[model samples]
Every structure is written in structure tokens, then in C-alpha cells.
Target: MGGRDVATASIWDAAHRRTTVGLLTLVTLVAFEAMAVGTAMPRAVAELDGVAWYAWTFSAFLVTSVVGMVVGGEVGDRRPPGPGVLAGVVVFAAGLVVAGLAQHMAVLVLGRAVQGLGAGVVIVLLYVVAGQAYDSRLRPSLFGAFAAGWVLPALLGPLAAGLLTTHVGWRAVFLGLVPLVAAGLVLLLTGAPGGTPPADAAPWRSRAGWALLAGAGIAALQYAAQRLDLAAAGIAVLGAAALAAGLRRLLPRGTVRARRGIPAVVASRGLLAGAFFGMDALLPFVLTEQHGWSAATAGLPLTAGAVGWVVAAQLQGRRPDVPRQRVLRLGALVLTVGVAATATVAVPALGGWPAYLTWGLAGVGMGLGMPSVGVLLLDQSPEAERGANSAALQISDATASAICVGLSGVLVAGAADAGGPLWPAVLAAVAVLTVPALLTARVAGRTVAPAADPSCATNLGR
Candidate 1:
């Protein structure tokens, strides 16, 4: 159907209402979990006495999620997406149980790994659902709904998590969501249409093996970063080699090199994620440790950032005529400024108050740029390659974020050992990490093909 013809139909119309609600519920819950974790993690780490392994909590989840994404993509292609999505829900809920009941940092990390697996499967399968069940015209709207799913979570998740952690303990943050997941699962089973499975199953063994290797590599790197011994060197080398090998198979050809078109889009996504989330995961820690703020108070800045992200994304959505590449570049620029400004919080005299505003600016950058990458990825990918590419986009995002977080963790540990000002080290790390955002801005133009339609790029993958 033409765009104008389909404009009259709403995603909330009778045909799509049930499935839409179900999908949005799942998306919101997942978003809430992600947002809540950052707020709860600082307290959780301190209580477990696993302060040394703080980065591992995030890295493990991100690294393990690569395995889940690969599996979800393979399953979605070969069989019914419902079963895989259901399995994801079960696994995710189980992880929450494990994390909530944890006694030590190791157990918490393990639970996080489990959560990663479920999150990966659920996320990829959700994309599959959108593609198979919804009309092409309705997909833009569906994706818009997906963006909307993050709104409430962004607004309230950090604050809610902080309050829970301060009053009820961090375990409550994890356990509290179990019932909501069950509700979302019921919604999906009842409302979502099950499309016909592929006639023949494609072999996924090779991809799965690579994903495992990559996950292992990421975990090893995170572990090694915390250790000061010589053995850490060998481990780091081995991990890098494995990560490189795995990425070669998992990503589109030349993605690491940032070859133009889809490859550049994929690469840009990784760089943007690495630069943004690498710091985001640490902001709460920065606030609590350096500023002497309560967990709830520390989370308010994150809330500000989320609000900015949503607002900028809404503005981007309204201006369909704006070229995506331009928006992507502009977002990168704004994000770069935000990251730089945010680093000043590490300075004792500046105070943490500025971060709330600066991080919000960074969020606006992400809002404008991140969604643009998703739209471009879909526009550029062939239909047959869409599922795989979608998985690649996710893998890229997670991999980069894990690496950045681990690097930050190392700096954090160093600052503790030095016993000087922690903010100075944080500032240096932010300076180094902000390079990726600058790089992303430089390559943003290559994300679009020379002859592509900018209007069509406004649809899908968000």
C-alpha cells in the first residue's frame, strides 16, 4: 500500500491493537529493566562487597547477550518466533530471580549473564514479530511505539529503582518485575499472530560458535582489565584475538573498517553506543561516590538525560524531510559536547549538578542519531538479510558498550588505588572515550548510499 493510503490506519486500530499492546508492554518492561539496573547497581555492588568486579556486572550481561541475539536470529528464521520469545521470557525471569537472591558478586554477574541471554532473544524476536505480523506501512508506527516504550521507563525507572534500593534493597528492583514479565508473556501469546515458519531450517552452528567465542572474548577482557598481574596481558591478547575472529563472522563485511553504506551505519551504531553507554553505566557511580549523593538523588540526572532523549527523538520523528545523515551527524556532535561537559563533574569544584544538564544534552544527541541508524539499516538491507543485519546491529551495540564499560571500570579501580580525586581519572577516561563519538560524526555521511531516498529511510529498525 502507498504511504498515503496506509496513513488512515492506526497501529492501535482493531487489527493491530492487541499485538501492538503486547509488543509495547514487552518493550517497556525490557527498557525498565535496563534503566533500573544502572540506578540499583552502585548499591548492589557495595552490598555484595564485589566492588572490584563492578564492571563485570554490566560486561557479562552485554557479552552474553551476543549469544542470545545469535540464537534468537537463527530461531526466528528457522521456526516460530513465539517459542523463542517465550523461552526468552522464561530465561529472563529466571535471571531476575537469581540476581535478586544472589549472595556474592559472582552470583550477581551470573544472573546478569542470564538476563542478557533472555534480553537478546526477546529483543531480536520482537523485531521479527514486527516484520512478519504488521503491514509495511504500519511498521513505522510500530517502531515509533517501540521508541515510546522507552519513554516511561526513561522517565521513572532510575528514580523508582533508587527509591526501591534505598528503602527496600536492590533485590526488590530485580524481583519486582517478575509479575510484569508474566503479564507481557500472556499478552504476546494471546494477541500476536504466528506466521508460517520457514520451509527449511538454515544451519546456524557456525554463527553460534562465533557468537560464543565473541562472548567469551568480551568476558575475558572484562576480567583481565581488573587484574594487575602479568597473566592479565596474555588473557587480554587472547581475548582480543577471539573477539576479532568472532566479529569477522558476525558483522557485515568491512563494518569494523567502516566501509560505506550499511557497513558504516552498523559501525556508527557501535561507536555511538560505546561512547554513550560506556559513560552512562558509570554516571551513577560517579554521582554516589564522588558527590556523596544518595542513590535516589544520583539517579535524577539519568532521568534528565532520558527525558532529553525522548524529546529530541520526537522532534526528529516530526521532521521527516530532514536527511537522516545530517541528523545523525548533529546528534553525534551534541553527544560529544555532552560527554565533554559531563566529565567536568569529576572536578571537585564544579559539583555534580552540571552533569544532570550535560547528560540530558547527550541524550538528545542519542535521540536524534540512534533512531536514524536503525532506519538507515533497514532501508539499506535486503529483505532476506534484514533479520541477520538486525542482529548484527544489536551485537555491535552490546559489544561496544561492554568494551567501554570495562575500560571505565579499570580507570575507576585505578582512581581508588591512587586515593586522590576520582574525578580526574574519570575526566581522562571520558576524554579518551569521547573520540568514538567524534569518529561517528565523521563517518555519519557514509551511512547513506549516494542514490538512496531520504524519505523511505524514515521507516523501520527503530
Candidate 2:
């Protein structure tokens, strides 16, 4: 046990310390931005008189992020992750600056789109770096640390952003991240490798074109979801078809079908993200409007969940003897239970505090399952394919979460008009999403692949 403890502690040793810290810091910055934006956005929209376009603010970011992920994946496959990370940081900072100075909501949305692109690139590159730089034994710990990095941001980002928006201005939230992005760039460049892979025979332009189509289709679908007319329904159907076609070409061939092996892993990621994030986006609104809580108070459940996520991730990382697939299955089950428990908060008799506990439970499930998916993807992919596959994993997650959130918005809006509790609609949407997650969990357990590295094979031998 002592020897094992020493081995785990070595992730922060001189040989690995720089890259680990750089990556963790990068993740922390992203987490802070995401949480802070959520807190600040309501004020920003009100100030800009863009209440009608509220949903588009988030949808724009998510849709454009697909384009960024595809481009980053191709870049990482053909070159080192360092260059892509640097480019992403620069672009992300530029977006932050644009957003900070924006006087209109349209400009703010465009700025967010740019930020999403940069974020997509940065996240994919980070995954590639993990695949290329870290040994298999260290991957779990690295992923766990990544989750842990979110802890502080999740705890403080909302309260801080609320304070800033209340006293200073919402623009400060966007502007403040610029310096952090610069620092992250320096750290990433210093720690990450600077080598290029052999060029691919396939043309990246074609893949990029498909990614654009996917993004457009997703955006259209989100727009359509906001309307209730038959015309909007027709548009949504057309958008879904386009999205499916583009994804078929972009992801692994079997991804939509959830074929065993890497495809199942990717599908599971989508299901998990859709189920969790869709509900997460609505929780604050539900708490504030229905339960009459302040934004800071509503955000407390999110903080609790972040803490739970890190704890579970740490526990999973320490137990490498367990199968990654088994962890995924167990996590999915736990998440289902948590989601179900959270729905009870909608009952007037139960009140809202139960959400703090249940959402944390949901976070624990995510911590257990989410990192394991990354490990499984790395385990299954060849070194040459890591970048592309990592992009697929992220694309799946982004697309699913976007669609589910859009649908939830429609449902909640309709419920609000019907003069009923909106929380049940949000909870129902989340509950429905869990079906795919639960089904995919079993499929994920059935598919196994050889380890990416020989040294790590024993750890994944199960």
C-alpha cells in the first residue's frame, strides 16, 4: 500500500509536475469562466435588452465549439498539442476582450461564439496532450486532478460573479479572464511538447467543412426548439437530419448506433453529459424563480456537486485495479439515482435543500464515470488516432448537451405558460435523458480494447 501511495504521489514529481500543474491551471480557468458566465449572463441580457435571445447566448457557444473541436483535433493529429493550445488561448483571450467591450447583446453573443471556438480547441488539445505525454498509470490521476481543479471555481465563481455584477459590472466577468488566459498559454507552452506528427494522407479541409455543417445544423435546431409553430417543427426536423448526416461523417462510423468499443465510449459520454448538463443549466432558474432563492444561494448546489465530483474522481483514480467500464456502469447507476432524488425537490413538501444533497450525488456519479470514459478512449485509440478520437468524444458531449438543453428550455417555457411548476418539466427532460445513459452503460461494459501502451496493459488487464 505504501509503495502504491508513493507511485501515485509521483504524478507531481519533477518529471511530471510542470505539465500536470499547467493542465490543472488551464482547466481551472475554464471552469471559472463557465461558472462566472452563468451568474453574470442574466444581468448582461437585461442590460443589453436582449431577454428574447437569452437561449441563443449559450447555444451559439456550444454550436461553434464543434467547429473548434474539429479543427483542433486535426491540428493535434498532424502536429504537437502545444501549438493548438497556444492558438486556442490567444483566440479565447481575444473573444474575452470583444465580449468585455460589447454594448449590444448581438456582439456579446458573437464574442461568446469566438470564445466557444477557442475553448473547444483548448479542451481537445489538452486531451491529446494527456494521451501523448502521460503514461497510462498517470492518466487517471491526471484526469482526477483536472476534475479537482474545478472545485474552487465551482465554489466561488458564482458568488464572486454575483458580487461583481451587482456592484461593479457584468463586463468585468468577461474582461477578467483575459490575463488568466495569457498565463495559461505560457504555462502550457513551457510544459507541453513541441513536435509534429507525420502528415495525414486525408485532406483536413473536407473534415472541417463537415464540422461547419454540423455546427450550422445544431444552431438551427436550437433556434427551432424555441418556437412552437409547425414551421419551426419542420425546420427542427430538417436540422436534425443535417446534424445526423454531418455527425455520421465526423464521428467514428458506428458512434450513432453505439457500437461496441470506442463508439460505445463516445456514445456514453454524450448520454452522460446530456443528462447532467441539461439539468444543471436549469437548476439555477428553477431555484431562483420557484423557490425564491438568490442566485448565490441557488448556486450552492452546484458547488456541492463540484466537491462531490472531485471526491469521486480521486477515489476512482486511486483504484486502478477496477475496470474502467465497471466504474462507468456504477457511476451511471448512481447518477440515475441522484437525478431521481433531485426531482423530489420539485415537491413543495420537500423544499429546495434536498437539491443540494442530490445534485452532489449526481456530481459524484459524473466524477466516477466521466474521467473513466477518457481513459477508455485513450486505451482503445492508437497514438496516431488520439487527437481525432478525442475530438469525437468532445463533439458527442457538446452536441448532446446542446440539444437536450434546448429541448428542456422549450418544455420549461411551455410549462410556465400552462401555470404549473417548471421544475417538473426540467426534471422530466433530465429523467428522459438518463434512459440513454443507463442503456449505454451496459454496452460500455461489454466492449474492451487493448491498452494504448504496453506498460499500462496490466493495469487495464481486466
Report the Cα lDDT for residue 383, model 2. 65
lDDT string for model 1 (1-462, tens) is: 567646666668876788888898888998899889988999999899998878878878877789888888777777777888999999999999999999999999999999999998888888777776665445544655676687678787877998999999999999999999999888877778876676655565548789989988988887788685699889989998999899999898989888888889989999999998888878888988998889778878877787887778767765555677888999999999998888877977777999889999998988888877876776676544556777888889878987898888788878878788897788878997799999999999889876575554555424
The alpha-carbon lDDT assigned to residue 384 of candidate 2 equals: 69
- Report the lDDT tens digits of candidate 2 across residue range 1-462: 266755656568776677787888788887788778988999899899999878777777877788889988888887778878989888888888888898999999998989988988998889888887777677777888887876778788888898998999999998988887787777767876666674542455547777878887888898897776789988898889889888987898787777777888898899888878777777777777778889768878887888889899999998876778888898888887877777766776666889988899989999998988888888787766787889999999878888887877788777887998776786676677667557756666644544433435877776
- Between which residue pairs do clashes occur in model 1? none
In candidate 1 the C-alpha lDDT for residue 401 amounts to 83
Q: Where does model 1 exceed 4 Å of error?
A: 35-60, 97-113, 133-141, 158-176, 189-193, 197-206, 284-296, 346-348, 419-424, 450-462
Candidates in order have lDDT scores of 0.83, 0.81
- Give me candidate 2's TM-score against the actual structure: 0.89
